[model samples]
Every structure is written in structure tokens, then in C-alpha cells.
Target: MSQTPIRRLAAREPEFLSTLDALLAFEAEADGRIDAAVTEILQAVRTTGDAAVVEYTRRFDGLDVQSMVALELPRSELLLALDSLRPEQREALTIAADRVRVYHERQKGESWEFTEADGTRLGQKVTPLDRVGLYVPGGRASYPSSVLMNAIPAKVAGVGELIMVVPTPRGEKNPLVLAAAAITGVDRVFTIGGAQAVAALAYGTQTIPQVDKIVGPGNAYVAEAKRRVFGTVGIDMVAGPSEVLIISDGSGHADWVAMDLFAQAEHDELAQSILLCTDAGFIDAVHDAIDRLLPTMPRRDTIARSLANRGALIHVDSLEQACALANRIAPEHLELALEDAEDWIAHIRHAGAIFVGHWAVEALGDYCAGPNHVLPTMRSARFSSPLGTYDFQKRTSIVHISQAGAQHLGKVASILAHGEGLQAHARSAEMRLKV
Candidate 1:
């Protein structure tokens, strides 16, 4: 395929601005399908249970799933297979898992109670959920990193039980995924995936038990299924397509920035890869590198569509303008390719994960990096935090009012309740005052 010529223009070029708007519009339109699909998957999972899950797996995965019982993997075999992994691979996984565990252990919270002015004890109790279900996507691509990312945090949070569901095509499990699960100390493994796996997790089958929260990454259908099953069981977040925004001032090597963009774009056609640069020369150079490298990649078609549609070389007037644009997009991954990145970090108000400096690539954060790769995607960075130990745990506010404390608080409560015209609430407080 002939490489598309790299377009070079001034920072304020009208052509680049129009192209940016067109790409943004396309991404906005793509979200429509996600909403509709999630609704269908959720309703199906809610009412049909195992039957719907089985049928959907067969339809979507092209696997003739006879029963949900096949979802369970024998614990012994999983461990044995893990023990057989190449020593180097096992060592790397161990190292990564340890780093992840250490970082998350620091994020763990403690329960504390304190006596208030009126001798009323007020506190917060931190406790892990009884059970959590993790969904691992399987097909041609299996992410052992994802297994480590999701399972280790839950384990560190002190969750009692950790069950995982990975959709293996035709019930054939990947040893690496199993090894990661085994090494991470996952309680159980289920060979199921797609919307069906999510359904099984949200509403338990005869074999798969329901869980308190479902966490991990998956395809569009899986994301939608999570959105639907939300109220039935907690979900980490409704993730969108992968994205990365790099702010470079032409100081970094063009090849590095190009590869970083490709890493995210290779995820899917909907993935967004953007470069915000003040230097027109750097923009052209990076574009040149991308064109030259594109054909060599295995997922060239996916990368091409992603870049042509959703990705762009955004020419910002200055670094400040680039940072402002980034805050608006709230990209899943933000790469600061500038000379002095730390100086700009304080100005960055939104981003799921930030990779500062040329040496720190997004790929590092995806694998061996201790930070969780399961991040808030699209615009969710504006509010939600990256998946952490807290996602697997819940907090309960504790309040204990003594007789004297109640008497003091009751008068204020009654007054407020009466102002709101809630007579029962007012009387309830009045009754407490009388006692």
C-alpha cells in the first residue's frame, strides 16, 4: 500500500482545524452503537441467565457452548500449567505482580472511629467485598498483564474470594493467562467471555456464582454488558476505545512518538492517537515516521483506519494550548514528549494515565509499570479515577449516638425535618428527645 503523504502546515492552519473537528464528530457517532448494544446485553443477562449467555457466546464467539459448566477450570490443572511456564516469563510475571502489589498495598485504607464534640462516635469502616469477578478477554489476543492488573489489586485489598472468567474460543484456555491467574492467586477460573461472561458474572448460573463487583477490560459487547449489569452488581467503569495524546515540541525523536501513537491505535479501529505539537517540522517528521512504519505493522488496516478517522496531527499554537486541548479530551493515555514535562504536569487537570518524558512510553505503563493499566477512558478522567484497590473495597460510615448525644442532635434534626415538611421524621426526632 502506498503511504499517505505527510501533511505539513502552520500551527493555525484552517485545514488541520477542520480535520480535527471531523475526527471528533466520527468518534461521537461511534458511541451510539455502544449504548444500544449494552442495553440489549444487560436485558438478556438479566432475564435469560445461563441460556442467554450460552446462546450469545455461540453467536458472537462462533463457539458451540453446550453448557455453562464448561466455564469452570480445574484448580489443580491451572496451577500445574502455571508451574510449567518458561522460567524467564514466570520471573517477569512475578516481578510485575510484586511491584503491582506493593503499590496497591500503599493505597489500602484503614478503619477509624473518633468521638465528636457531643460524645457521639463517628467513623468510617473500610472492608473488602466478599467476592469479586474479573473478566479477561481471550481470542487471538490474551492479556496476562490485565490478569495481573485486575487480580493483584483485589487480592491486596483483602477480598475474600476472587473469581475470573476468560472467554476461551471453543473452550481452549491459554496457558499464559492461566499462569498469570495462578501466580496472582485468583480463587477460581471460568472459561467464558464476551457479553455472556459478563452476564454470568452479574447473574450467576447454576455453576457460576454471582459476585459483588465485576472488573477488567473487554470488547464493545462486554463493555455494554457491564453497563447493563451495573445495578445488579458494581462495575469498574464503562470503558471506551483506547486513546493517547502526545504533546511534543520537536525535541523528542520522531520515531518514539510515532510508535507510541501506533501502540494505542493498534488496539482497535476506534482507538484515537493524536499528536499536539507547536513545531511544524516535528509534526511532519512524526507523520513521515508513521507512514513508513504503518505498512510493516501486522495490524496495518486497523491502525490506518484509526489514524485516518479518529487520529490526527493537531497543530497547537503553544504548549499551553496543547495542555488545554488535552484537558478537554481527557484522553485515556497522555504522553508528554516535551523537554521539561514535570513543569507541565500541574497544568494537566484530566487524563487516565500520564507518561512524562521521552523515556517513559505508554507501553511501559501497560505492562511492567506498577500503575494499573485499567484506566478511565474517553472523558471519564474528568471524574473517575483509575482502577485501584478501592474499586474492590467498600466504605461504610459509622455513627453511634449516646443518649446524651441523641438528645443534643434530636433538636436540630427535628427543626430541619419540620422545615422539609416531613412530619414523621420530625416526630421521630421528637420522640428521641422525649426519651
Candidate 2:
């Protein structure tokens, strides 16, 4: 097999930043047709309710059903799916669920307050969303892992209800996905997806209950739909393609590093995978490893296209330089595949998740490694974070003013309110003051 030559850049090159920027750039352009279609679907679901959902399901998924009840999978069906799984499958799923639940439990926020000497109590009350919608991809793209990553956090956060929507193309349902819903305590499972499902979740249908927030990955149509309904309902994020950036020293095995890059590249043709090494000789060895191992992968075509388009093998002067470039990339998944991986962690200012040392593969974190896999991509990690218990929860500020406290605080508030040209606010504060 003739291998595609991955792009190589040097840290010393004058155009290095420009070259990297071009590769990292992935802007989500709204397709006019998709947007129009989504708008129609959203409006239809809002106005017509279940009838529109049934029609879209028939039109898109080839599922001819008379009633929306046909689309709703019962809790017994979820239990049946769980029972049907092989012992090994059930065990693995259970273990992963346990780990994810345990990890997210620690992130559950508690209501806290501190009373002042003047009897003024100020604090925050942490509360979970009443209901949340989870979109899990179905058909040929079945991801049980995604179910665990999204649902477990919500359950841990004490969300009142966790409703899931998965498209069952041709009326075929993946058992593993159903089992995951059962394991994660999803309140309802609807075999509807795309823009319609999002709409149903946003605007309550007779059958599908409205959700406080929607979280999970979906196709371009689903993503655009989520974007349009942002203020109407909260969405996790309209994520871009997956990314993995590895900063490796020459000490690690070349084969391991090459496989790590391949694991990420195999996700999709646009998924970016880059490696930064201080040793040029090690980069050559990784190149050879990629060529030798490329034939063995099932998704070699995808890996090849991704590498040819976005992948890079960079030569850096030192590990410090590699860390600097990593922060600039702000990749979704970062691997410090080096001897002293811990030493450089403090230097990294951005990344969705950091996989330390050679043995700590990013794939583990995606599944049973006890962290959420729904991470920010396309440099959004510079400011955002991986989906967690916090996403499913919210906080409300609490304020109780005592006579003594308000008298002292009202004067300060009046000054600020008056400076902002709000006479009403200033007068309101002044009325509470003794003076």
C-alpha cells in the first residue's frame, strides 16, 4: 500500500504557526438547506406535536408507524436488552458504568453558605436540572460508550429525569444502547433522532416530554438544530471533529506513539492527529511505524485521509517547546507520552483531557477511565471543558439582608447603581438604609 506522506513542520520554521493554523482551522458553516429543513421540523413539532414527529420518522428513518407510542421503547424493553447481553458484555458495561458514576459523584455540587457577624447570609444553592435530553447516535454509528459518558453524569448530578433520543433507522435498535440506558437510569427512551428529536425535547410533545438541557453528539443536522435552539433550551455544545495531540520525548516506544495517533485518526477523515517529538530520529521511526501498521487497521482509508489532510509529525527543540505548541493547538485530547509527563502538566494551559505517560491511552479515558468523553473540539478546549456532572446542574445565588447589613451595604449599592444611571435601583437601596 502506498502510504500518504503526513505533513512535517519544524519549530524553527518561520511559517510554522501559519501552517499549523491552516491545518487546525475547521469552521462549521451552516448549510442553508439543513437550516431551513431544521426550522421547518422544529416549527412542525412545536405546532403539530406528535404527528410531525411520526411523519419525520417515517420520512427519514423509513420507520412507518401509526402512533408515536410505537416509537417509545418501554422500560421492560430496556431491561430485556440488558438481560440479553452476553455475560462479558454486561460485566464490562457494568464496570464502566460504576467507574463513570463514581467519578461524576465527586463533581456533584452542594449548597453552601456562610453567615456574617451582622446576620447577613449569602451563598449559592446548587440544583440539578429537572429534566435533560440525551441524543445518542444510532444506525451504523451505535455508541454505547457515549450513553455512559452523557447519562451517568446527569444521574450522578441528581437530575430529576434523563430522557434519551436515538434514531433507529429501518426500525432496528441496538441492544447495547438500550442496555446502557437501563444501566444509567434513563427515565425514557425514544426511537427518534435528528432535528425533530431535538425539537421534541425543546418543545414538549404529547409523547416526548420537554427537557431542561440536551447533551450528546449528533450529525450535522442535529448539531445545527441544537445551535438554533440554544436560548430556547440549553445544549452541551456543537462540537467539531475529534482531535489528539501527543507531546512525546524520544524515550517512549515508537510503535506505541504511532498507534496512539492512529487511534484518534481512525475516528474520521477530518479528525486531526499530531505528534511533537524533540528527536528528529524518533519522528522518522514513528513514520516507519505508521507505514508498517497502517495495513492492519480496519479503518485504514479513514486513517489515511485524516493523516494526509490534518496529521503532522513535528520536530521540536525541547519538550518545553512541544508544550508551548500544544497550548496553541488547544486540542480536545492531549497525550503527554514522555518519561516526565507530570513535570510538563503544569505548563499545559489548555486541553479537554490529558493522558499522562505512555501507558495512559486516551481511549481508556473515552470509556472506563472514569472521565466524561464528550469533550470540546476545534480549539474550544482553550475555554471550555469536558461534559460532566456540572453540566447537568445549575446554581442559584441566595441573598438575605439583615437591618444592620443592609444599612451598611445599601450605601455602597446606591453609589454603584446611581453611577450606572439607574435611579430606581439607587432609590430602592436608599429606602432600605437608615440614613
Candidate 3:
């Protein structure tokens, strides 16, 4: 087996910041080929609608279905998939779905307003989207957890329609994914994927209803399609590769930490798994543990490539320095595997999600930890956020002014509009004002 050598860094080194910056940078923009292909697909769907969708499905997924109705999976089919799952599989899906649903239910926003003394009311009205589309990766990347994370939130947010699109490459489907959709109340499921699915959702077709927003993860083509169709429809985000940054105090077992790193690396060859610690001796111990354990993993080749390329083991002067570096990276998943993990929680200014304590493995959060695992990646945590019920809902500002309130407010508007040199705007406000 090939050995995975983790890059070593020291906070005291003169070029530490420059090296760290290079490692943290991840290019998120799609290439021209993907962008052009996505553009063509979007235009095709926009022009031809259902015919373009069918042709794309046939071309990409190797499915020769003639009509869109043949591509859709009925609600009964979703239920049947749920029932067909093994006992353990069904149990796990049920538990995960329930937890995700419960967690998002608390995120539901309400319409709120406050009345003022001048008979004016000011507030924000929160409303669920009319329809949302979920893009689940099919084939080798089938993820039942994604179905739960994306659909359950939309349902909890009171979205009227939850449409799902998963490609059945060569007419193959994963029953667990369908079961998850059934458990989470997905209103519709289509056996379609890639850029065409995104285009269909954004532009709508003769059969597939146009959605207000499109959420969930997909491949490069699907991501590019989302990027192109964003203005026409809302998208969750253009997610990048998986990542995990672990800060250990050397209080826990090295094997546990090694496994956590492996778990992150196994996602793909580009996935990052970095470890930061104050103790040099503990870093060596964890290195040995990784060497001893790498051969045992089924995805060792991928993990090895990931660690060799993107992974690192940093020696910080103190835990304080580790926290500072962590904030700079703004990783997607930050695991503080220390005895006093909660003590330094407030110090972390940016991270998509924090897994505190030795036992709080990032893998647990990926599945049934109750928090949505769909998070900002590629340092996007600096400004973005995790997927939640709020992503499926939108807010509108509400203002109701009485005659007395308008009399005073109109004066302010009139002055501002006239100063900006707009006669129509100034007159509109002046009409509401009385002497």
C-alpha cells in the first residue's frame, strides 16, 4: 500500500501565514467548458421545455423514456421503496428523518409586527416558498442523508411543494434514497439529474412544475447549471469539496483522532483533513496511528491521495494560536477534540459547524446528529451559513401607516426624493402629505 505523508507546519515558522494561505485556497468558480455546457442546457430547457429534458435524460442517464410522466416516481412508489428497505435501514432512515424534521421545525419563522404610538405598524412577514427542488446525486454518489437534510427542512418551513430530482443512471435507483424522500414528505420525485434537472427546475417544463428555489448537492455540471439559473430561481449555494479541521489538546486517544481524519479524507482525493495541536509528541503518535490504520481502510487509496495532497499536521505554539488559525481557515467542519473544548468555543469567530469534545466525531454529525450536515465549504463559512428551514423561507418587510403617521413620514420621503432630483418620487410622497 502507498503511504500518505501528511504535510507538517509550525506556527513559529517565518513563512507560516503564506503556506497556510496556499493550503486554504480552493477555487470555486467553474471552468469554461462546464459553464458553456450548462448555458446550453439551460437555453435548451428554456426553449423546448419537456422535449429538451427528455433528450438530455436519454443522452446523459442512458434512459430512453419517451415522456416526462415515465420519468416521475409516484408517491406510492416512494412508499413502496420505504417498505422494501431492510429492517435496520428503515429504522435508521426513520430516526434520521425524524431528528432532522424536529430540528428544522424549531427554525420556522413567524410574521411579527410592532405597533407604534402614531398608529403605525412595522414588522417583517416570514413566508415559506411556494415550491422547492432538491437535486440528489445519483449513481456512485447516492446519499440518503442528503434527502433527509434537504427535504425535511423544506417541509418544516411549510413549503407548499417539495420536488426531488435524482438521476437513475442506466435505469438504476437506490431504494434507500426513495425511502428517505417518502419519510420526509417529498411531494414529487423525478428520475432525472445533471444540468438538465437543474434547468428543468429553474425554468419549468410542460410536466415538471417550476420551483421557487433549488437546494441539495450535485456534480460540477449540476453546480454550473445552478449558478446560471440563480437569478431566475433561488439556489442554496454552490458547494465545494468536503473539509474538516481538528484541534486536539492531546487528551484523547490518538486512534480516535486518526479515525476522524481518515473519515474526512475518505470523502474524496481533494477533501482536506488537517490536525492542529500544541504537543509535538502527540502529533507523532497520531502520525503513527494513521500509518498503522491507513491499510485497514477500504477507501485507503482515496484517503491516501487526499492526505498526501490537501491534508496537514500543524504544530501551534499554543491552543490560542490554533484558534486563530482555525478562524482564518473558516473550515466547513471544525472539531475541537480537547478536554475543555467548550471553553474555547467563544473564541471561534467563523466555522460552518463545531463538534466539541473527543466523542463528538464529525461522522456522527454527517448522519443523525440532528443538525443539518449541508454546510458551507471552501472557506465560504466566512460569510455564508448552513442549510436550514430558513433557506426554504423568505421574509418581506411590512409597513402600515395611519393618516397621522403618513403626514410626518411623507415629509421625510419628499425631502430625500427631491434632493436626489426625482420629481415623480417627490410628488408621490408630497401627495400623501397635508399642510
lDDT of every predicted structure (CA atoms): 0.84, 0.93, 0.92
Error of 2 at 210 (Å): 1.1
Instruction: Order the candidate numbers by TM-score, best to worst.
Output: 2, 3, 1
Give the TM-score of each candidate: 0.91, 0.98, 0.97
Model 3 residue runs over 4 Å out of place are: 1-3, 28-30
Question: Which scores greater on lDDT, model 2 or model 3?
Answer: 2
Which of the predicted structures, 1 or 3, would earn the higher lDDT when compared with the native?
3
Clashing residue pairs in candidate 2, if any? none
lDDT of 1 by residue, 129-218 (tens): 999999998877899999999999999999999999888786567788999999899999877787778877888877778999999998
- Candidate topping TM-score: 2
Scored by Cα lDDT, where does model 1 land? 0.84
Candidate 2 per-residue lDDT, tens place, 1-435, comes to: 325579988989999889989989988775889989998999999999999999999999999898899999999999999999999999999999999999999999999999999999999999999999999999999999999999999998999999999999998899999999999999999999999999999998998888989999999999989998899899999999899999988899998998999999998988999999999999989999999999999999999999998999999998888999999999999999989888989999999999999899998998899999999999999899999999988999999889999999999999999999999999999998885
**RMSD in Å for all candidates:** 3.0, 1.2, 1.6
